[model samples]
Target: MDAITQNLDLFWNGFLRSLTICLWGGVGSLVLGTFIATCRVAPVAPLRTFGTAWVTVIRNCPLSVLLFMFAFGLPEIGINAEYYYFGLAALIIYTSAFVCEGLRAGINSVSAGQAEAARAIGLTFTQTLTQIVLPQAFRTSIPPVGSVIIAMFKNSAVVGAFGVGLDLYSVGESLTSAQGFAALPVLTGVAIGYLMITLPAGVGLGVLERKVAIAR
Candidate 1:
Protein backbone atom coordinates (compact mmCIF):
# COMPACT_ATOMS: atom_id res chain seq x y z
CA MET A 1 0.00 0.00 0.00
CA ASP A 2 2.77 2.40 0.89
CA ALA A 3 4.69 1.50 -2.23
CA ILE A 4 1.67 2.02 -4.43
CA THR A 5 0.79 5.37 -2.87
CA GLN A 6 4.30 6.67 -3.29
CA ASN A 7 4.42 5.88 -6.99
CA LEU A 8 0.94 6.83 -8.01
CA ASP A 9 2.22 9.15 -10.71
CA LEU A 10 4.33 6.45 -12.28
CA PHE A 11 1.49 3.97 -12.31
CA TRP A 12 -1.01 6.44 -13.71
CA ASN A 13 1.29 7.72 -16.42
CA GLY A 14 2.18 4.16 -17.32
CA PHE A 15 -1.45 3.23 -17.65
CA LEU A 16 -2.23 6.21 -19.88
CA ARG A 17 0.78 5.58 -22.08
CA SER A 18 -0.18 1.94 -22.47
CA LEU A 19 -3.71 2.88 -23.38
CA THR A 20 -2.46 5.41 -25.92
CA ILE A 21 -0.18 2.87 -27.50
CA CYS A 22 -2.88 0.23 -27.69
CA LEU A 23 -5.43 2.58 -29.21
CA TRP A 24 -3.19 4.16 -31.81
CA GLY A 25 -1.43 0.91 -32.56
CA GLY A 26 -4.69 -0.96 -33.07
CA VAL A 27 -6.09 1.71 -35.36
CA GLY A 28 -2.95 2.10 -37.40
CA SER A 29 -2.47 -1.62 -37.85
CA LEU A 30 -6.10 -2.20 -38.78
CA VAL A 31 -6.07 0.40 -41.55
CA LEU A 32 -2.75 -0.70 -42.98
CA GLY A 33 -3.63 -4.34 -42.59
CA THR A 34 -6.92 -3.90 -44.35
CA PHE A 35 -5.17 -2.30 -47.30
CA ILE A 36 -2.64 -5.08 -47.42
CA ALA A 37 -5.34 -7.69 -47.19
CA THR A 38 -7.08 -6.08 -50.13
CA CYS A 39 -3.89 -6.20 -52.06
CA ARG A 40 -3.44 -9.85 -51.25
CA VAL A 41 -6.85 -10.66 -52.62
CA ALA A 42 -6.70 -8.20 -55.48
CA PRO A 43 -7.29 -9.21 -59.07
CA VAL A 44 -3.88 -8.03 -60.15
CA ALA A 45 -1.10 -10.57 -59.75
CA PRO A 46 1.46 -7.89 -58.93
CA LEU A 47 -0.65 -6.56 -56.11
CA ARG A 48 -1.09 -10.03 -54.68
CA THR A 49 2.64 -10.64 -54.93
CA PHE A 50 3.41 -7.37 -53.20
CA GLY A 51 0.98 -8.13 -50.39
CA THR A 52 2.35 -11.64 -50.02
CA ALA A 53 5.90 -10.35 -49.79
CA TRP A 54 4.93 -7.77 -47.20
CA VAL A 55 3.14 -10.25 -44.97
CA THR A 56 5.83 -12.85 -45.39
CA VAL A 57 8.64 -10.49 -44.51
CA ILE A 58 7.03 -8.49 -41.75
CA ARG A 59 5.23 -11.41 -40.11
CA ASN A 60 8.36 -13.54 -40.09
CA CYS A 61 10.50 -10.84 -38.51
CA PRO A 62 10.62 -10.97 -34.73
CA LEU A 63 8.84 -8.16 -32.90
CA SER A 64 11.87 -7.41 -30.72
CA VAL A 65 14.02 -7.05 -33.76
CA LEU A 66 11.55 -4.65 -35.28
CA LEU A 67 11.51 -2.61 -32.11
CA PHE A 68 15.29 -2.54 -31.97
CA MET A 69 15.51 -1.28 -35.49
CA PHE A 70 12.91 1.40 -34.96
CA ALA A 71 14.35 2.50 -31.63
CA PHE A 72 18.05 2.37 -32.42
CA GLY A 73 18.58 1.86 -36.10
CA LEU A 74 16.19 4.53 -37.39
CA PRO A 75 18.20 7.27 -35.74
CA GLU A 76 21.26 6.08 -37.56
CA ILE A 77 19.43 6.56 -40.84
CA GLY A 78 18.43 10.11 -39.87
CA ILE A 79 14.79 9.34 -39.14
CA ASN A 80 15.07 10.28 -35.53
CA ALA A 81 11.93 11.14 -33.62
CA GLU A 82 10.73 11.23 -30.05
CA TYR A 83 11.29 8.01 -28.11
CA TYR A 84 7.57 7.56 -27.55
CA TYR A 85 6.76 7.98 -31.22
CA PHE A 86 9.48 5.56 -32.22
CA GLY A 87 8.14 2.95 -29.88
CA LEU A 88 4.63 3.50 -31.18
CA ALA A 89 5.84 3.20 -34.75
CA ALA A 90 7.49 -0.09 -33.97
CA LEU A 91 4.34 -1.46 -32.41
CA ILE A 92 2.21 -0.31 -35.32
CA ILE A 93 4.45 -1.85 -37.96
CA TYR A 94 5.04 -5.12 -36.18
CA THR A 95 1.41 -5.69 -35.36
CA SER A 96 0.11 -4.70 -38.76
CA ALA A 97 1.27 -7.96 -40.34
CA PHE A 98 -0.76 -10.02 -37.92
CA VAL A 99 -3.75 -7.79 -38.55
CA CYS A 100 -3.34 -8.30 -42.25
CA GLU A 101 -3.40 -12.06 -41.87
CA GLY A 102 -6.49 -12.04 -39.73
CA LEU A 103 -8.36 -9.82 -42.15
CA ARG A 104 -7.22 -11.93 -45.05
CA ALA A 105 -8.64 -14.98 -43.38
CA GLY A 106 -11.94 -13.19 -43.02
CA ILE A 107 -11.80 -12.07 -46.63
CA ASN A 108 -11.14 -15.63 -47.71
CA SER A 109 -14.09 -16.87 -45.71
CA VAL A 110 -16.42 -14.80 -47.92
CA SER A 111 -18.04 -17.04 -50.48
CA ALA A 112 -16.83 -17.13 -54.09
CA GLY A 113 -20.45 -17.10 -55.18
CA GLN A 114 -20.93 -13.75 -53.55
CA ALA A 115 -18.14 -12.27 -55.60
CA GLU A 116 -19.61 -13.90 -58.73
CA ALA A 117 -23.02 -12.49 -57.97
CA ALA A 118 -21.58 -9.05 -57.53
CA ARG A 119 -19.79 -9.35 -60.83
CA ALA A 120 -22.96 -10.56 -62.50
CA ILE A 121 -24.72 -7.52 -61.19
CA GLY A 122 -22.12 -5.32 -62.94
CA LEU A 123 -20.01 -4.58 -59.91
CA THR A 124 -16.33 -4.01 -60.35
CA PHE A 125 -13.92 -6.04 -58.28
CA THR A 126 -13.26 -3.12 -56.00
CA GLN A 127 -16.94 -2.34 -55.55
CA THR A 128 -17.78 -6.00 -55.08
CA LEU A 129 -15.25 -6.39 -52.30
CA THR A 130 -15.89 -3.09 -50.62
CA GLN A 131 -19.66 -3.39 -50.56
CA ILE A 132 -20.50 -7.06 -50.50
CA VAL A 133 -17.43 -8.92 -49.26
CA LEU A 134 -15.70 -6.80 -46.64
CA PRO A 135 -18.84 -6.26 -44.57
CA GLN A 136 -19.40 -9.94 -44.04
CA ALA A 137 -15.69 -10.56 -43.73
CA PHE A 138 -15.40 -8.08 -40.88
CA ARG A 139 -18.14 -9.87 -38.97
CA THR A 140 -16.30 -13.15 -39.32
CA SER A 141 -13.08 -11.36 -38.42
CA ILE A 142 -14.13 -9.78 -35.14
CA PRO A 143 -12.80 -12.62 -33.00
CA PRO A 144 -9.34 -12.79 -34.55
CA VAL A 145 -9.11 -9.02 -34.73
CA GLY A 146 -9.95 -8.80 -31.05
CA SER A 147 -7.31 -11.37 -30.26
CA VAL A 148 -4.74 -9.41 -32.26
CA ILE A 149 -5.61 -6.19 -30.48
CA ILE A 150 -5.27 -7.90 -27.09
CA ALA A 151 -1.88 -9.26 -28.07
CA MET A 152 -0.83 -5.79 -29.17
CA PHE A 153 -1.90 -4.42 -25.80
CA LYS A 154 0.44 -6.81 -23.99
CA ASN A 155 3.26 -6.40 -26.46
CA SER A 156 3.25 -2.66 -25.81
CA ALA A 157 5.38 -3.49 -22.79
CA VAL A 158 8.30 -4.22 -25.07
CA VAL A 159 8.80 -0.49 -25.59
CA GLY A 160 9.85 -0.20 -21.97
CA ALA A 161 12.96 -2.18 -22.74
CA PHE A 162 14.08 0.74 -24.87
CA GLY A 163 13.76 3.11 -21.91
CA VAL A 164 10.54 4.73 -23.02
CA GLY A 165 9.50 6.51 -19.83
CA LEU A 166 5.80 6.35 -20.61
CA ASP A 167 5.60 2.59 -20.49
CA LEU A 168 4.48 0.68 -17.41
CA TYR A 169 7.44 -1.63 -17.37
CA SER A 170 9.84 1.29 -17.56
CA VAL A 171 7.99 3.18 -14.85
CA GLY A 172 8.01 0.21 -12.53
CA GLU A 173 11.72 -0.29 -13.05
CA SER A 174 12.38 3.37 -12.44
CA LEU A 175 10.55 3.29 -9.11
CA THR A 176 12.44 0.22 -7.99
CA SER A 177 15.81 1.64 -8.93
CA ALA A 178 15.35 5.23 -7.83
CA GLN A 179 13.09 4.85 -4.79
CA GLY A 180 14.24 1.45 -3.68
CA PHE A 181 10.62 0.34 -3.92
CA ALA A 182 9.75 -3.27 -3.28
CA ALA A 183 9.82 -5.06 -6.58
CA LEU A 184 6.95 -7.41 -5.85
CA PRO A 185 4.47 -4.73 -4.87
CA VAL A 186 5.40 -2.45 -7.72
CA LEU A 187 5.09 -5.31 -10.17
CA THR A 188 1.79 -6.39 -8.70
CA GLY A 189 0.42 -2.93 -9.21
CA VAL A 190 1.69 -2.96 -12.75
CA ALA A 191 -0.03 -6.28 -13.41
CA ILE A 192 -3.28 -5.00 -12.01
CA GLY A 193 -2.91 -1.83 -13.99
CA TYR A 194 -2.64 -3.82 -17.19
CA LEU A 195 -5.64 -5.90 -16.21
CA MET A 196 -7.68 -2.79 -15.61
CA ILE A 197 -7.16 -1.78 -19.20
CA THR A 198 -7.21 -5.16 -20.92
CA LEU A 199 -10.19 -6.61 -19.08
CA PRO A 200 -12.68 -3.99 -20.25
CA ALA A 201 -11.29 -4.13 -23.74
CA GLY A 202 -11.73 -7.89 -23.82
CA VAL A 203 -15.23 -7.67 -22.49
CA GLY A 204 -16.18 -5.00 -25.00
CA LEU A 205 -14.76 -6.98 -27.88
CA GLY A 206 -16.55 -10.10 -26.70
CA VAL A 207 -19.83 -8.24 -26.63
CA LEU A 208 -19.20 -7.01 -30.14
CA GLU A 209 -18.40 -10.54 -31.29
CA ARG A 210 -21.61 -11.89 -29.83
CA LYS A 211 -23.66 -9.18 -31.44
CA VAL A 212 -22.01 -9.74 -34.81
CA ALA A 213 -22.62 -13.47 -34.50
CA ILE A 214 -26.28 -12.94 -33.73
CA ALA A 215 -26.62 -10.53 -36.62
CA ARG A 216 -25.16 -13.19 -38.92
Candidate 2:
Protein backbone atom coordinates (compact mmCIF):
# COMPACT_ATOMS: atom_id res chain seq x y z
CA MET A 1 0.00 0.00 0.00
CA ASP A 2 2.75 2.40 0.94
CA ALA A 3 4.70 1.49 -2.19
CA ILE A 4 1.73 2.20 -4.42
CA THR A 5 0.59 5.30 -2.51
CA GLN A 6 4.06 6.76 -2.55
CA ASN A 7 4.52 6.08 -6.25
CA LEU A 8 1.02 6.72 -7.53
CA ASP A 9 2.26 8.78 -10.43
CA LEU A 10 4.65 6.08 -11.55
CA PHE A 11 1.95 3.41 -11.34
CA TRP A 12 -0.47 5.61 -13.24
CA ASN A 13 2.03 6.24 -15.99
CA GLY A 14 2.79 2.54 -16.25
CA PHE A 15 -0.88 1.71 -16.46
CA LEU A 16 -1.38 4.18 -19.26
CA ARG A 17 1.58 2.83 -21.21
CA SER A 18 0.37 -0.74 -20.82
CA LEU A 19 -3.09 0.32 -21.93
CA THR A 20 -1.64 2.07 -24.98
CA ILE A 21 0.33 -1.01 -25.95
CA CYS A 22 -2.72 -3.22 -25.65
CA LEU A 23 -4.88 -0.82 -27.65
CA TRP A 24 -2.52 -0.55 -30.63
CA GLY A 25 -1.44 -4.14 -30.44
CA GLY A 26 -5.02 -5.36 -30.36
CA VAL A 27 -6.06 -3.27 -33.32
CA GLY A 28 -3.00 -4.18 -35.37
CA SER A 29 -3.41 -7.90 -34.71
CA LEU A 30 -7.10 -7.83 -35.59
CA VAL A 31 -6.57 -6.04 -38.89
CA LEU A 32 -3.58 -8.09 -39.94
CA GLY A 33 -5.17 -11.29 -38.74
CA THR A 34 -8.35 -10.61 -40.68
CA PHE A 35 -6.30 -10.09 -43.83
CA ILE A 36 -4.37 -13.28 -43.26
CA ALA A 37 -7.55 -15.18 -42.53
CA THR A 38 -9.03 -13.93 -45.79
CA CYS A 39 -5.94 -14.95 -47.66
CA ARG A 40 -6.03 -18.40 -46.10
CA VAL A 41 -9.52 -18.88 -47.49
CA ALA A 42 -9.09 -17.16 -50.80
CA PRO A 43 -9.23 -18.90 -54.21
CA VAL A 44 -5.65 -17.95 -55.00
CA ALA A 45 -3.28 -20.78 -54.22
CA PRO A 46 -0.33 -18.46 -53.68
CA LEU A 47 -2.23 -16.41 -51.16
CA ARG A 48 -3.29 -19.52 -49.31
CA THR A 49 0.33 -20.70 -49.25
CA PHE A 50 1.55 -17.41 -47.90
CA GLY A 51 -1.09 -17.40 -45.23
CA THR A 52 -0.25 -20.95 -44.23
CA ALA A 53 3.44 -20.19 -44.06
CA TRP A 54 2.88 -17.07 -42.00
CA VAL A 55 0.74 -18.80 -39.41
CA THR A 56 3.05 -21.79 -39.27
CA VAL A 57 6.28 -19.87 -38.81
CA ILE A 58 4.99 -17.17 -36.54
CA ARG A 59 2.83 -19.39 -34.37
CA ASN A 60 5.76 -21.73 -33.86
CA CYS A 61 8.30 -19.07 -32.94
CA PRO A 62 8.65 -17.96 -29.33
CA LEU A 63 7.49 -14.47 -28.44
CA SER A 64 10.80 -13.62 -26.75
CA VAL A 65 12.73 -14.52 -29.87
CA LEU A 66 10.41 -12.39 -31.94
CA LEU A 67 10.90 -9.50 -29.51
CA PHE A 68 14.67 -9.86 -29.75
CA MET A 69 14.43 -9.85 -33.52
CA PHE A 70 12.24 -6.76 -33.58
CA ALA A 71 14.24 -5.00 -30.88
CA PHE A 72 17.75 -5.80 -32.11
CA GLY A 73 17.54 -7.22 -35.62
CA LEU A 74 15.51 -4.34 -36.99
CA PRO A 75 18.26 -1.89 -36.05
CA GLU A 76 20.78 -4.14 -37.75
CA ILE A 77 18.79 -3.78 -40.98
CA GLY A 78 18.68 0.01 -40.63
CA ILE A 79 15.05 0.07 -39.53
CA ASN A 80 15.55 2.16 -36.48
CA ALA A 81 12.60 2.91 -34.25
CA GLU A 82 11.89 3.45 -30.59
CA TYR A 83 11.94 0.43 -28.33
CA TYR A 84 8.23 1.08 -27.69
CA TYR A 85 7.39 0.53 -31.36
CA PHE A 86 9.55 -2.55 -31.52
CA GLY A 87 7.80 -4.05 -28.54
CA LEU A 88 4.42 -3.22 -29.99
CA ALA A 89 5.47 -4.71 -33.33
CA ALA A 90 6.53 -7.94 -31.71
CA LEU A 91 3.26 -8.21 -29.77
CA ILE A 92 1.21 -7.41 -32.86
CA ILE A 93 3.01 -9.95 -35.02
CA TYR A 94 2.91 -12.74 -32.47
CA THR A 95 -0.67 -12.23 -31.37
CA SER A 96 -1.87 -11.79 -34.95
CA ALA A 97 -0.95 -15.37 -35.80
CA PHE A 98 -3.27 -16.73 -33.16
CA VAL A 99 -5.87 -14.18 -34.14
CA CYS A 100 -5.58 -15.40 -37.75
CA GLU A 101 -6.10 -18.98 -36.66
CA GLY A 102 -9.13 -18.05 -34.56
CA LEU A 103 -10.70 -16.16 -37.42
CA ARG A 104 -9.91 -18.97 -39.84
CA ALA A 105 -11.78 -21.34 -37.58
CA GLY A 106 -14.71 -18.93 -37.59
CA ILE A 107 -14.53 -18.70 -41.37
CA ASN A 108 -14.68 -22.47 -41.60
CA SER A 109 -17.72 -22.43 -39.32
CA VAL A 110 -19.56 -20.37 -41.91
CA SER A 111 -21.73 -22.59 -44.07
CA ALA A 112 -20.34 -23.41 -47.48
CA GLY A 113 -23.79 -23.30 -49.03
CA GLN A 114 -24.06 -19.56 -48.42
CA ALA A 115 -20.82 -18.97 -50.28
CA GLU A 116 -21.99 -21.19 -53.12
CA ALA A 117 -25.30 -19.37 -53.24
CA ALA A 118 -23.49 -16.08 -53.46
CA ARG A 119 -21.28 -17.41 -56.22
CA ALA A 120 -24.31 -18.66 -58.12
CA ILE A 121 -25.80 -15.19 -57.90
CA GLY A 122 -22.80 -13.84 -59.89
CA LEU A 123 -20.91 -12.68 -56.86
CA THR A 124 -17.13 -12.79 -57.06
CA PHE A 125 -15.05 -14.57 -54.41
CA THR A 126 -14.17 -11.24 -52.85
CA GLN A 127 -17.77 -10.15 -52.73
CA THR A 128 -18.92 -13.43 -51.24
CA LEU A 129 -16.19 -13.31 -48.60
CA THR A 130 -16.64 -9.68 -47.78
CA GLN A 131 -20.43 -9.65 -47.90
CA ILE A 132 -21.53 -13.13 -46.95
CA VAL A 133 -18.78 -14.79 -44.95
CA LEU A 134 -16.77 -12.37 -42.87
CA PRO A 135 -19.71 -10.81 -41.05
CA GLN A 136 -21.01 -14.07 -39.68
CA ALA A 137 -17.49 -15.29 -39.16
CA PHE A 138 -16.68 -12.32 -36.98
CA ARG A 139 -19.71 -12.87 -34.80
CA THR A 140 -18.95 -16.53 -34.33
CA SER A 141 -15.27 -15.77 -33.72
CA ILE A 142 -15.82 -13.31 -30.88
CA PRO A 143 -15.09 -15.80 -28.14
CA PRO A 144 -11.78 -17.12 -29.33
CA VAL A 145 -10.70 -13.74 -30.61
CA GLY A 146 -11.58 -12.17 -27.28
CA SER A 147 -9.58 -14.78 -25.47
CA VAL A 148 -6.58 -14.13 -27.71
CA ILE A 149 -6.79 -10.43 -27.02
CA ILE A 150 -6.85 -11.05 -23.28
CA ALA A 151 -3.82 -13.27 -23.57
CA MET A 152 -2.09 -10.60 -25.56
CA PHE A 153 -2.84 -8.11 -22.81
CA LYS A 154 -1.14 -10.39 -20.34
CA ASN A 155 1.73 -10.95 -22.71
CA SER A 156 2.31 -7.21 -22.91
CA ALA A 157 4.01 -7.53 -19.54
CA VAL A 158 6.89 -9.20 -21.32
CA VAL A 159 7.39 -6.09 -23.42
CA GLY A 160 8.62 -4.18 -20.37
CA ALA A 161 11.55 -6.57 -19.98
CA PHE A 162 12.54 -6.00 -23.60
CA GLY A 163 13.08 -2.24 -23.05
CA VAL A 164 9.56 -0.83 -23.00
CA GLY A 165 10.10 -0.02 -19.36
CA LEU A 166 7.09 2.20 -18.86
CA ASP A 167 4.71 -0.68 -18.30
CA LEU A 168 3.41 -2.16 -15.05
CA TYR A 169 6.04 -4.88 -14.78
CA SER A 170 8.82 -2.38 -15.22
CA VAL A 171 7.21 0.00 -12.77
CA GLY A 172 7.20 -2.72 -10.16
CA GLU A 173 10.84 -3.43 -10.92
CA SER A 174 11.69 0.23 -10.55
CA LEU A 175 9.89 0.57 -7.24
CA THR A 176 11.54 -2.47 -5.75
CA SER A 177 15.04 -1.98 -7.13
CA ALA A 178 15.42 1.77 -7.23
CA GLN A 179 13.11 2.91 -4.46
CA GLY A 180 13.79 0.13 -1.96
CA PHE A 181 10.19 -0.94 -1.79
CA ALA A 182 9.33 -4.43 -0.73
CA ALA A 183 8.87 -6.76 -3.69
CA LEU A 184 5.57 -8.11 -2.40
CA PRO A 185 3.62 -4.84 -2.26
CA VAL A 186 5.13 -3.63 -5.49
CA LEU A 187 4.22 -6.86 -7.25
CA THR A 188 0.72 -6.75 -5.83
CA GLY A 189 0.29 -3.28 -7.23
CA VAL A 190 1.52 -4.49 -10.61
CA ALA A 191 -0.91 -7.39 -10.60
CA ILE A 192 -3.76 -5.06 -9.73
CA GLY A 193 -2.81 -2.76 -12.53
CA TYR A 194 -3.01 -5.62 -15.02
CA LEU A 195 -6.27 -6.79 -13.49
CA MET A 196 -7.67 -3.33 -13.91
CA ILE A 197 -7.30 -3.80 -17.65
CA THR A 198 -8.02 -7.50 -18.09
CA LEU A 199 -10.87 -7.98 -15.61
CA PRO A 200 -13.16 -5.47 -17.23
CA ALA A 201 -12.22 -6.76 -20.64
CA GLY A 202 -13.09 -10.28 -19.58
CA VAL A 203 -16.45 -9.24 -18.27
CA GLY A 204 -17.23 -7.30 -21.38
CA LEU A 205 -16.26 -10.25 -23.55
CA GLY A 206 -18.55 -12.50 -21.58
CA VAL A 207 -21.46 -10.15 -22.15
CA LEU A 208 -20.62 -9.97 -25.84
CA GLU A 209 -20.42 -13.74 -26.08
CA ARG A 210 -23.86 -14.10 -24.58
CA LYS A 211 -25.28 -11.49 -26.89
CA VAL A 212 -23.75 -13.14 -29.93
CA ALA A 213 -25.09 -16.47 -28.82
CA ILE A 214 -28.55 -15.00 -28.52
CA ALA A 215 -28.27 -13.42 -31.93
CA ARG A 216 -27.20 -16.73 -33.42
Best by TM-score: 2
Mark the regions of model 1 whose C-alpha exceeds 4 Å error after superposition.
117-127, 214-216
Instruction: Indicate which candidate wins on lDDT.
Output: 2
Clash pairs of candidate 1?
none
User: lDDT score, residue 160, model 1?
Assistant: 67
What lDDT tens digits, residue by residue, belong to model 1 across residues 183-210? 9899898899889878998999889888
- Tens-digit lDDT track of model 2 for 46-128: 99999999999999999999999998899898999998899999999999999999998888888889899999999998899
RMSD to truth, every model = 2.2, 2.2
Instruction: Give me candidate 1's TM-score against the actual structure.
Output: 0.89
lDDT of 2 at 198: 87
